[model samples]
Target: MQLVLVRHGKAEDPAARPSDLERELTTTGRSTVKAMAKGLRLCVSGKVAIWTSPLPRARQTADILANAFRVKKIREHDAIAAGDLEVLASDWRDLDPQPKALILVGHQPHLGSWAERLTGAVLPIKTAAALAVDLDEDSALSGMLRWYAHPKVLAGLADR
Candidate 1:
């Protein structure tokens, strides 16, 4: 299966909200994500499932992707917000019909960690950046990085 890891778009200043989970995407962030989603749509094909952190920023990013891909359901899971790869793997194993492609939208550092774990590459996951990995059919944990795109690059691709 293909795994696409995305860092949530730029959000309000951390101090602007009492809870980080409540912080929302800035106007510019939303537009950037929309363009990035267009680029992402160009790269991925087949049925795709989107899972996102419960946090507002991540959820908003997932929403944009859902629209871009015309995906009907977006799963909101704590494992994504908590960045628990173990739980994510267990949940994925439990999927009734695993999708051909999966997109995970979440925060940084954690997303970067996941990329490193899956691809053995030290990736710098900037906000709104995305990395694609092809997971081993035998084990979800094992995969190779297919590509990594910064928000700027993806937005540029959207113009094509």
Candidate 2:
């Protein structure tokens, strides 16, 4: 299975919101989304499916990427959802997709932890950044890391 992990765009400072869940993406965050979308549109040339955190920023970023890809397929996953990392890894480890590719849009700490838990490697999942892993059919949750795309790199695609 091919897994793509996307960290949600930068959001408003949590202190300004009543709850972290309510904090929306910043203007720069939206730009980041655009960049991520632009980047994906260039690389990974294939049909794509999207999964996202319920958070506005993540959902919004998914929206941007979905639009860019002309892909309407989107779902919500608790793995990236403020839940347990080990559990998410176990569940996702068993999916056969309806889309040509899989993209997961979510938040940090959980995203970072799940990535490490699944890949057995520590890599920073920066805001709006995405990492892609290639899993052998028999690969375990802690499979080998393939390659990843940073939002900054994707955003750079716009200028090229």
Candidate 3:
């Protein structure tokens, strides 16, 4: 299965928001994420499933991806926000009808850490960046990093 890890777009600072989970994506965040999502659409094919952190920022990002991918629904998974890599992997393994591609939208360090754990590459998962991993069929915990790019690069790709 192909796994796409997407960091949520730039959001309001924690200090400005009463709750971290409530922090909304800024206007620029929405625009950049839309561009990034369009670029991602060029790289993906077949049935795609979108999973997202429940936090407002992540959910908003996921919504943009859903529109780009033309997927009607987004699945909100707590593990993505909680940074429980094990549970996320297990859940991926247990998907009854696995999608050809799974896109996960979530927050910072966690997304970067998960990418490193899966591909053994310490990637800088910038805001609105995306990393694509080809998961080994036999091992849920391991994968190859097919590609990684920040929003600028991805947005550039959208033109191609």
Candidate 4:
């Protein structure tokens, strides 16, 4: 199974939002995510399952990815929220047949930590960045890092 981890895009300044979960992506964030989405489109084929945190920024990022990937629906899961790695793993296990490719849009530290836990590699994932892992088994810790694309790198690729 192929799993893709994505960090939510740059969000409105914390001071500007009353609640962290209410923060939305900034203008630059949307543009960068669109470019990253373009690059992501080149990486997979067929139906892709998209799971996103209910937070506004994450939901917005998921929307960009869904549109780019032509995904029919995006599932909102509290498990995908920041710092919920264990829940995320459980959610993965609960999927019936499992998707050929799964795109999970969430926040930092957690995304980075999840990537490391899955591939056994410490990957620095920036906002709007994505990491692709190929799992030999359904286990969260049983995967190889196929690729890690920073938002800048993906944006550059989209330009090519």
Candidate with best lDDT:
3
Per-residue CA lDDT of model 2 for 36-115, tens digit only, reads: 78877776667677888888878888888888888867777766777565555566655664344678888877777767
> For every model shown, what is its TM-score relative to the native structure?
0.97, 0.86, 0.97, 0.93
Task: Give the TM-score comparing model 4 with the true structure, all chains together.
Answer: 0.93
List of clashing residue pairs for candidate 3? none
Count backbone clashes in candidate 3: 0
| Candidate 2: regions farther than 4 A off | 85-98
Model 3 spans > 4 angstroms off: none
Please identify which of the two predictions, 2 or 4, would achieve the higher TM-score against the true structure.
Answer: 4
Better of 2 and 3 by lDDT: 3
Give lDDT tens digits, candidate 4, residues 73-158. Answer: 99999877857777777777778888889999998888888887877899878899998889767466578999998888887876
TM-score of 3: 0.97
Question: Clash totals for all models, in order?
Answer: 0, 0, 0, 0
- Candidate 1's TM-score reads 0.97
User: For all the candidates, what are their Cα RMSDs to the real structure?
Assistant: 0.9, 2.2, 0.9, 1.4
lDDT of 3 by residue, 1-160 (tens): 9999999999998998888879999999999999988888888889999999999999999999999999999999999989998998999899979999999999888988888899999988889999999999999989999999989888989887
Clashing pairs for predicted structure model 2, backbone only: none
Regarding lDDT, does 3 or 4 come out ahead?
3
